[model samples]
Target: MDTQHDIALTRALAEVPGPLPVSGVIHVAVPHASRFTVVGNHLAQHAELSLTAIGIGVYIQSLPAGSQVGIKALAARFAEGETTIAAALRELETHDYLHRTRERLANGRMVTRTVFCNQPGALLRGGAVAPVTVASVPRPVVTPVVPAPVVAPEPTPVPEEGPPPVRLPSRIAPKPPRRPLPQPREPTPELHRAASALLADLRRHAPELVLSEGDVEELVPGAAAWLERGAHPDAVRHALTTELPQPPKYPAKIVRHRLTVLLPPPLPGAQELTAAPRTPVTPFQTCEGCDRAFRSPAPGHCRDCRAQYWEAA
Candidate 1:
């Protein structure tokens, strides 16, 4: 009976579930003998960094010296767009994991240099290992043995020719005359109001075009000139807003440049307004003899009436 009880207890225990197997990551780490990068837990488990940024930081740290890590190069290697890669690089820079600076090369070309820090905190705290300086050893001076003295020959001088030839002056090409700037029309109250409204409304099409009140007032004359020249309001707006720089440094300056440089010529009919007026046509006159209307310079008679009177004479 004891054996039976023991067997029953063993069966019951076997049937019961032993704490459900822990559901979590299991490390299967392998010791790397070569070509391995050591990443600190601070960076690998960074709370603020996104997965892409952390991964990029680690990749940059692992790269050999003088590797191309520009946004375009990184984008080509990874499955990310240039913008995303650039943002990740900026994130690494912000966290002190990376330092990028624009340097001008000896050839006068600008280049960006990137420096990766394995231990950002250490670097920030100025904890970098000092370079080892080797002490210079003194060498024993050797005595020189003197031999028989030898005489040296002197160089022969050449005779001078007549006066040096005169050099002709180089001909300089004449510069082309610059185009005259377009002058703004005399601004009336209506023109000023229209120009102001156009300048203010530019921000609606492009948020970067936001202008201050003073800038708008200053730009009003140029915008008015565009309008006075036969350019439609839409055309002027397109000229001002289209193909703007990635981030316009000075929006008002851009508008002013476009207004002055791209101003259209005035309408053809506009210039012909000073021509003489046309003479009026002859009016219709009623002939007194036949009671018939006819076109004449005066109201006296028609052609037929004048012919009859002449015949009677």
Candidate 2:
């Protein structure tokens, strides 16, 4: 091909996504002749015993030696009377060991190119600045590894069998005295509640016992978790002592379950309070105990008065 045609083919080859199959090139070069080489995706075609075969054989041989085959010119030369390039290509396709590709020109023309070897091989045409090579597919190359040497363990010295013997060595003195134990920390309110709950259990289940508040406090450390859950101490101790389906001795689970059981439906926000007050308060007749006035407080007395009145009544 001419230099202009060659440059055009180079640009076309570069435009291809990767190496072209020779078939791809042929498809691109269907109506136009171009000078190009294949980089990837081989062609499959048959070439009978003809000038085309000879030229292809020659072209294959000339590749590593660096020769350019103006593919269109070569096809014209080989595709003489009654013999078609397609037929020749069909024959060439019988060979399993060849790699081929097709490239397209700017005008959407194709040139089918081929190589004798498999992929990652190159095809160099004359006057081209760079040779076309298929990108290599990675393959793992396994190498045998030598194992490290085994180390022999040192033998432990064994004492000979004998009777018991005397003691020795007064040089090392005993360790110095440790400081006195730390003062105990006070139990938190939650711990106190939990302890009381457990003590309540003892009061019920183990009715014969009389444990002082201090004794209960001491035992609190062990059962304070139950008390914190608002459980009575006696019930907690009975459950623990009796191995009744006692809860897991963890405050988190206990409190969580307690809240889950005791939780009421959520109250509506102020936005939902659409009703007006039904019972308005009066200024006089305040309860003596609470001093808050109310209109006809329960039993005709205010909260404090009612408390005293209820106590007396």
Candidate 3:
């Protein structure tokens, strides 16, 4: 492999191993704009192919640790709009940056490993690109949007028939048309009753369970019907215990109270606990060939450095 190119690749990878934005292009420059121009030109031209080929590598580096790579997640990062996940994954295999491993998850979903690009591959080592021979690749997944259910209108009621021959005209003038009666409000007695009952039951059975205002709001729906029927407090309590079998238990009360009590008083300008003392490690001799230091005990110098030192001697 070309050492200079390898060095540049490593440097660029170090700079952009994380999920970086396009704005990070400035970090690629070493010091001066002139040196940056030379490096930038090379990357923009010769290194572009390799850098672009490692699209999945860039993606793998960006992912959270232990997270299984999914096609949806890959697509959102790499393809975005220009290409589909299926296409990018296919190309990735061609570049030898990723491989698929099949397994069954606990939920019985067919799981696959989207391998990292750290392992040596022919193309990655500047070898020729090989043809992909895999029989099956995951297709681009698009979730379909489901429309809401349609409700049909109720049929109109038919009018009763009247006798046509016996028409007794009692009124000398035409009578005014009668207006339609307004629909009665829907019955909410059941709702109020249920809410009231639930509240009462909580107070009686699970008195230890401290409920917040939000919790009460949520519980009210259960006893709404009872509340609407002018339910007495005692009747509401009885109805709640009888109707709802589950007692109101606040699982988080102990946790909340514990948290409140255990909270340490705020220490303004408090210093952190002193770290444990560290034992002295063996001294490392400086390399003669390079600036790197080695931790070998009784070492004269690094092998490479010693060789250079001897050559100069």
Candidate 4:
């Protein structure tokens, strides 16, 4: 619709052969132009400065010392959304209003540190201005422009309406990451000694329940498992060392089966475990070659004896 102001604007913009003189003054504060903090109005509200960016900046600056807030919290506080906030924050980062830095705490945890700036295009490191950082200003991230609805005088031909088409992304499920394969374990002499010692301890209580080398190896793990579950060694000895049934033909087999089937449960509490006087155990296995005691087993030889035997071999 044609209006008086529209007609005047049209006439003013029209190209003519001869020039019609027109001039105007834009009043600006000289003090604002001179001061570092007092930015020129156009500079203050540059194309990069969205309403969301300005609001985010204000919110950051207004936060109290030792206070921390997250992007989701900010979205909830402003009654906006995560996507909108993220886009605004991206804009802020590109324009150098802020940059996110990864910081490590004394406790060895990683945290994201947002450094805010009243002025754009400044170098920073974890909320502190870094004078050492050379200035190389980054370009701003462009926000998407949405076209306005066009109203027409006459009705246009509309396409036949149907249900919206299903997207490819919505149907497919993402696959989980594959795990790495397990590595084989190596055996040590102390592990062997432990199995032999456990069988030796069991023989002290029940002489008939004899275990072969292979049986000792298998039963050692079960005893170790019971110990790990907080059962006392004495309790395990009592539980497995039961009365012989008649002549006890296969006592060893019966004992091994009982040990396997009836593994001890974890100790109920600290007091139950501490009720009996518990002594710190220091394992001593004598070297067969040297007739000398050693803290750890070394194929029936002390470290010195073993080294000598290997060198001699």
User: Over the stretch 80-186, how does candidate 3's per-residue lDDT look in tens digits?
Assistant: 54355556556556645556667565655554645544333433567543322223325533322211111112222344677667878877788756432111134
Residue lDDT tens for model 1, 1-313: 9999989776765665554336864343334434455578888999999999999988876666667788877899999999999888889889988887776667555666677776778777877543322333354323222111111112223356789889998788788665443557687888889989999999999999999999999888888888887788999999999999989999988888888788888887845867788899998989989989998888898888899999999
Q: Report, for every candidate in turn, its global Cα lDDT versus the true structure.
A: 0.76, 0.46, 0.47, 0.58
Tens-place lDDT per residue, model 2, 3-84, is 9999987777677565677663333432212233332334323233455754464355334422333344456555453346
Best by lDDT: 1
**Candidate 1's C-alpha lDDT?**
0.76
Candidate achieving the largest TM-score:
1
Ranking of models by TM-score: 1, 4, 3, 2
* Pairs of residues clashing in candidate 1: none
Q: Where is model 2 more than 4 Å wrong at Cα? A: 1-55, 63-71, 103-113, 118-313
Candidate closer to the true structure by lDDT (higher is better), 2 or 4: 4
TM-score of candidate 2 on Cα atoms, chains taken together: 0.17
Instruction: Count clashes in each candidate, considering only residues at least 3 apart in sequence or on different chains.
Output: 0, 37, 26, 0
